[model samples]
Target chain A: MTPRSVLVAILAGRPNAGKTSLLMHLTGSPQRPINFAGTSVERVESRVVVEGTELQVVDLPGIGSLSALTRDEQEAIGFLQNRAAQGSERTVLCVVLDAVKLSVELRLLAQLSGLGLPLLVALTKNDVARASGRPVDATELERCLGVPVLEVNALTGAGVAALRQAILRRAETGRPMPLDIDPAAVAARVQPGSAAPARSLTDRIDAVLLHPLLGLPAVGLVLLAVFQLLFTGADPLIKLIEAGQAALAAWTVQQVPAGALQSLLVDGLIKGLGAILAFVPQIVLLMTLVTVLEASGYMARAAFVLDRALSSVGLSGRSFVSLVSSFACAVPGILSTRIIDNERDRLATIAVAPLMSCSARLPVYVLLIGAFFPPRYAALVLLLLYGLGIALAALVAGVLRRTLLRGGHSALLMELPEYQRPSRRVVVGQVWTALREFLVRAGTVIFAASLVVWLLSYYPRPAHIHAHYEARRAEVVAADPTAQKAALLELDRQEQAAYLEQSYLARAGKALQPVFAPAGFDWRITVGILAAFPARELIIPTLGILYSVGEVAADSYELGSLAQPGASGEGLRARLRSAVDAQGRPVFSTLTALALMVFFALCSQCMGTLATIGRETRSLRWPIFTFTYMTALAWVCAVLVFQIGSALGLGPART
Target chain B: MSHQETTLDCLPPGAVASVVRVEGEDQIARRLGDLGFWAGTLVEVVRRAPLGDPTQYGLRGYRLALRRVEARRVVVRPGQVP
Candidate 1:
């Protein structure tokens, strides 16, 4: 077998024309659905082998015309211009067209064809068009445009193989060739015949969907359904993932002897990463639902319904999709900001996007609330925390838009593509792509971060400490079988406590304690906060480790009175309830918990989100600005919550 | 009918018009043209947003939403006779 040169096949089309779906079908690559206008802000590449020929498919962002309107369109045009100038024999232009909107696509096709390239047109969505009794005549189109036109259904792989062969043949031809037909004359003959207008089914649907009175309620219901699917539908899958991780951890523990490597794998890497990985199901579900919404044409309608309210806060309607996705996880949410047309609006949206309470924060919030507050109040408290994040985000977005990101004239002129049945294949492809990307991107950062935290909590063990732990274990093993279990647990607790106290994390926490004192946090709370900056979910496992050493067993004591140990002793919650500061006042008071909740809700703690913002902006200025502002806001809000709550004498155990 | 010219935002819902010009001598006009709102194109106000600020309009076989601030920049002549 000989090596083949990579031939660049550029897939260009107007917005929402099934170009991405065609790409997925042609290359068998899982493509993410970005249905709204301007979402394809960058070029994506996929490699495929056809007849032993290597083809590098470059899917340029969708554009309305080669003339260019928004920044995204300009980018696509610029790429084409650059490629055209190179005059490389390796380049092949494949213009994708929506069969139902053939005339509209012809305008762009004509412009692209004028670039003097070996042009081939892929007429997509032929299934939908045929169902509507308006299937495009590929032969007529080819005769008119003087280019090879192939009808393709990306959903079912119809005509896909032939299209691939066509591309291979064109690349082999290896030269730019202008069409023999005149574009102006061809467009004039094919443009939906000016005498009779095509009244699409989309118009009938839009009559109710875009209705002033009915649209709002319908839009709200659609949004509610999406959120319900993301949160409730994904719950069981998340539990299953967590259970799997736990089983893996148990297996690892059974296989390895008690040593540093065992602890590192089981405690540092597994537990730490497992806590973060548990949210993948929710993110995948959100992306799938968003893709479906976009493909069905409702996403644009949703944006139209939301345009007024969003613009009031200095954001365009495009920010609605990105902001809502942030509730699942900020990394994908930040990436979705590509749909926003204006650079200033895009940056502003990215800046305040992380303020949405992500799934990562849910674990920490639930752990703290369940430990401190009653079970009956869980729903209300969770609602309040999410609401607080949203309110602060809106306020911050407004401020940023009026100041740093100011100066651009906001516009909302965007096309609402015709509605069609979302392909099941595309939806599945989207979910798979989102899951894989999240695992590769955010998952690695968290794994490394967990290892660093594990190292901090596991070093500098003195020989005497080891000797003391072994002696205690020996005494427990020799005792009566009835007391052996409890004695062994107590001995483990003592050993863990001693080891933790001498570790570097403890020293760092003690040094940072004074800085967090105003927010009512002690050294232990400070340690959790410091560790959680890399990944918000780390706080829960961090607290579990910290309290397991100093406290008794799990969930064995009452909430308020930590001193009253049950028959099996107390858990981490009881230990937290009974914890004390230097002045002997109990920590984890109701006020302090509220203060910490406020801090986590507002802070830019997730390294994944920051990294995404840097990648999207292609600059560090925005991420730095986001981090600095968010941290400042979090600190100020926490201080206020603590100070005011203390003044009012609130909390379970007031100092 | 009076020979009068008005911005697109002033047209009542359900009214039809033809775009006479895009007012701004800037990229906004060019962008509006690129989005199929060029001069001589037929346009009609389909509906307004719930808050009555951004209105949806049908043009060139598609629907688009334009806030009052942006709509005011497009000059249109009412198709109806007085």
Candidate 2:
């Protein structure tokens, strides 16, 4: 009935010392954020009960020396100097060091030794150093620093048991060894740290990743690979879900007494809900990839690459990581601005992060890109769209920082972790969690939102109004062989979508059609976009409904296929092709696609992202501003791109 | 060069340097190494990783790691290249 004594082990280290890798190995499987009571940085903690003692080992932020420059580094030092600061109050310090680079680390150890508190040195990356012919004498090093030093191969599970025992031994001791390191010596090393050396392998990696030429393309390539994988891998699963949804709808209609209730459940709820639910697989895939990237050292490098660039936009490079968090959902991403430590930078970062084109945007982008762009240019168009998002984010961020949130933005004082191969297990777990979250959202916000949109679109359904529809349905359902046979020719035409003029979604689309006409989007796209507001992936379902989805053979092009403009130019496909500007030429050209992608990527249309901003800031001002500005930006950008591009012979020149 | 001997630059990473300066800017640094570079103290670079940066050095019966970039920022004179 008693809780085990939770021993807190705080692992402190210099950058590139493989601290996280060691912690990952120490705490196997399903690692959660180890949140300290009051701090934003989760002191990476994992608890394990031993000998009736519950011990929590935290991988603290890497600090070069007790004398650090950045705020986080200072916090790390303060935590070590005063255990109460990290909230453990009784936490033990486990000084993690790269054996290959000991002398500098010893300074830290020496400082810890003086503290008189229980301290153990985890000499990590022994495998790496030993392979590279740089091995340290652990015993001698321990003797030299007057602290227990254990060799650990963080990559492999070597020496972990020893390290654990050492930690447990300290926890059992439960007494502080007062430190006595001369503070003067620590300060003498560097004159009041202006910042940790801004030049290191960390920043050098940024030089390439942040380069405009390679940066955008590299991002595009990574995104293309990830989405292509999602598109291909999720296809089979989506089909299964689609089949089930259809079967449920059919059964529901049979159970109902062929009245308004059946229509509401089947037409309004089923179609709209199905559209939103269908994107679960893609979201899971994205979350999985993101988790792996974050666990590996590459994500840190990404932040480093974007830091200077973000700074130019009145945001910190540290904001880059928070923005990346949006790919999962906007709530956490916006909340992650806490790490920014600067109000101006955090606000600016929050506003633009939604424009990074979160994974929710993935569904809409994929659908549009597949539908409009040629099959061969599928991935390229998708890539362009993502690129457009980043570009718009930069532009918007720059303007906001300069205009609204004016003043000096905090620069990125980052720790560049060494790159490592992503752990497959961690990624799998992340994917599982993301999938669970998506499903949960489906039943909550997305589900309710779907029902509402469905209700709005389904209500006031045109029943027995149109001559062609009323005449056709009467003849087909007459139950007489001659009546059905005579109506078969018209049956195909009736099924071709004469029913949409009767459905609820159609009317809503009709009302919104003129709004998007200037952008060359027809009623179908406008309806789809509206339905997708709650969940971007639901756009496909809205399109299916608008296009009279049921009769379209699932295996064939169905309602999802890219409908190109035919020579005749009459159908929905022709409308897409005939989207012309003032000069009367194709408007949806290559440049137009790029521009649309930019608009979509940067637009603040997602309700969830805005909701998240509102929640995090505890104010509607940010979300409202974010929404208005992004929409205006998207509209202007799209119009300019289409109009200018058409003039330069890019899109359909006439509307 | 006279006042620099007691500074971090006077004691660089690789070669042993007789600390000519010892005035520390803050307590954090002093607690790590010395109260600053001590005029009589000795420092020497012991090892560096493959990247040839973030070099470790031996001094005052303990080792300290300073990135090469940080070292360049610290002016040091070689007493004896160890």
Candidate 3:
């Protein structure tokens, strides 16, 4: 069929008007989010074939009116205007309206009707409206607006089929009619009672959730629960994924010959894949909770509850959602900033989001804490690292608002949608979308990065280094046959360490070592830090390789001293603990570890996050600014921590 | 009966009022108008946020949260609670 036979049905509505839910029902497919040209505003489009005619349903960013207020709203208006100009015969605008809030929503409907596009009304939440004694009569609405109106319950799938059929039919055969009815007048004439019940279910729920005395604490508890689940609840799943990856890597080693290809496949590709997969559990958990919160309409209340506190930092309540999402992963968090209407607030939120200590940083913190601090203090240090991230994020956001993003008064005008059961399909769809985007990044950017790192560490294998190790192995074999296997293993480790000492990565790390000397990091630690730029979790494995400990699972660093013999990651901790510099000075001290943790906590190391920031802001400038500022701040903090701790006799020399 | 006029921010929780007009030509004022805060629209102060800065208002069958700064721009005539 020609492309012209395909019909495009644009679902337009205000926020929380159930347009997304309705679109999901209509298409019977997961929505694909696409960025509009030259804008970061994402719109979801899904296609369904009905009766041999293709129908494309596009869910626009929700807006209050054609007179746009926010960037996304302007995007929606621009899109509609473009469609109108392009000749709207093949396009039908399906206006989704909340049956309970028809008066205000109808203002949008009225505005769209004036566009003279083929129109249809999908009145949602009829059940709630009817139960509240304010049911919208679809027949009366259809008569009044001179358009076919269908009442749809997206949750139960009631009336959805009829609505889909109506949309398709309207797109094919309907023509725009001049409608002269004022939305306010029509709403007043149809639904006369200007008063709603003093306490609806949502109101009652909000009464408790938004209680002046209890709301803040309630929000705190909710956030605590989310974080608890994200870190602890997903621990076992993360461990399971790590174990699976380790097993797969071991199996690959057994199947492949010992060569560069084997190392690349196991250490580079599989390890990178494992790093990507390791974050899935936490991201999935976080996104599921976030989607549920958003869908149930409690997110707005949480924003409201925190607005006053956040406003002190030049952020509105809306920034809280993005920041919280960043706690899981900054990629999704940056993407979610579209919901914030104010451009200045959105940019400020995006600027500080990466500082929220995402799950990727957990491995680095665990490795450093396990290596440096005592077991009892591990928890405290971890908490301090997380706190450092948050405190810095707040400070950075406040500073950004006062400087780069200053002077725009962000007025918080948000709709508190009626609380409903989070739609199962919608939640799953959202989680899937987040997972898909993350996996795509891992496959492309992470994969390429891992390959580049592998090449750097693997190449220039000088024959003399291998010959030296082979001679040592031969001498050990001749000297003692019984311990030949163990002796060869030692020689192999020495040979790998020797080879890496002169490799390009190590040379670069050494070149940059002086820059990081104030932070107490040696060449090896500098190399690990440099390698982790693409993904923060790579630091552990890179450190494992740098110390000649071989490939270690990113999560296994946590099992430090308690690890069983032959555990892959246990060797790295012991090596790092006893490792010394050229002058026989200890390479890593408690102060060094603290400085390193602080550096990791603040540095904008993740290329994925930077790319996402660039994409979201639609500019290279913001991402560059984010990188420069974060890196500079990290260096300053790391140096300060190192210098201050050293002066206070908190170094390895004192301990 | 005398008609009393005041900004929406001055209204107490549960006070019902009809909007007179959004007083400014700024984006926030136009946004308020877009959200059905135009003239003659009945709005109720549903509740205040926990910190009491942005307040929730019931208008046109939906609850909207507006900070005091934005609310201060909407002139309203207080009416008797039904």
Per-residue lDDT of A1-655 in model 1, one digit per residue for the tens? 7987678788998887777777777888655333223333446667788766787777777887666555577778888887777775778899998765554566677678778677799988766666655555678778876677888876677898999889888776656556555432453455443212246678789888877789899988987788777766877777677678878888998999988999899878787778567778889888888888888888888888888888889887888888888889888887777667777888888998999998888766765666666667766877898999989888998998888888887777777877878888767865676676567667777777778878988887767998988987887777775678877877787787778767888889989889888888888888888778678877765676677644223233222222233334335656677777668878788788888988999988877788778777888998898899999998899989998888888854653
Model 2 iRMS (Å) reads 11.2
lDDT of 2: 0.58
Residue A458 lDDT, candidate 1, scale 0-100: 86
Clashes of 2: 57
Per-residue CA lDDT of model 2 for A501-587, tens digit only, reads 555666777787786666656566666667666666565555554554333334332223434322221233333345553355554
| Model 1 fnat value | 0.39
The 10 consecutive residues of candidate 1 chain A with the worst lDDT sum are A551-560
Candidates 1 onward: DockQ, in order: 0.47, 0.09, 0.66
* Cα lDDT of model 3 by residue, B1-75, tens digit: 747899999999989898888998877777788788867788889888888888999987888899998899999
TM-score of each: 0.89, 0.66, 0.95
Q: Supply candidate 2's per-residue lDDT for B46.
A: 47
Q: What is the lDDT of residue B16 in candidate 1?
A: 85
Residue by residue across A521-557, what tens digits does model 3's lDDT show? 9999999988887788788877886777766645456
- Provide the lDDT at A327 for model 3: 91
Q: Which of candidates 1 and 2 is the stronger one according to lDDT?
A: 1
Per residue, candidate 1 scores C-alpha lDDT tens digits across B1-82 of 5547899999988888887888877766766665556556667887787778788887645567788987998898888323
Chain A fold similarity by TM-score, each prediction: 0.89, 0.69, 0.95
- The per-prediction tally of clashing pairs is 0, 57, 0
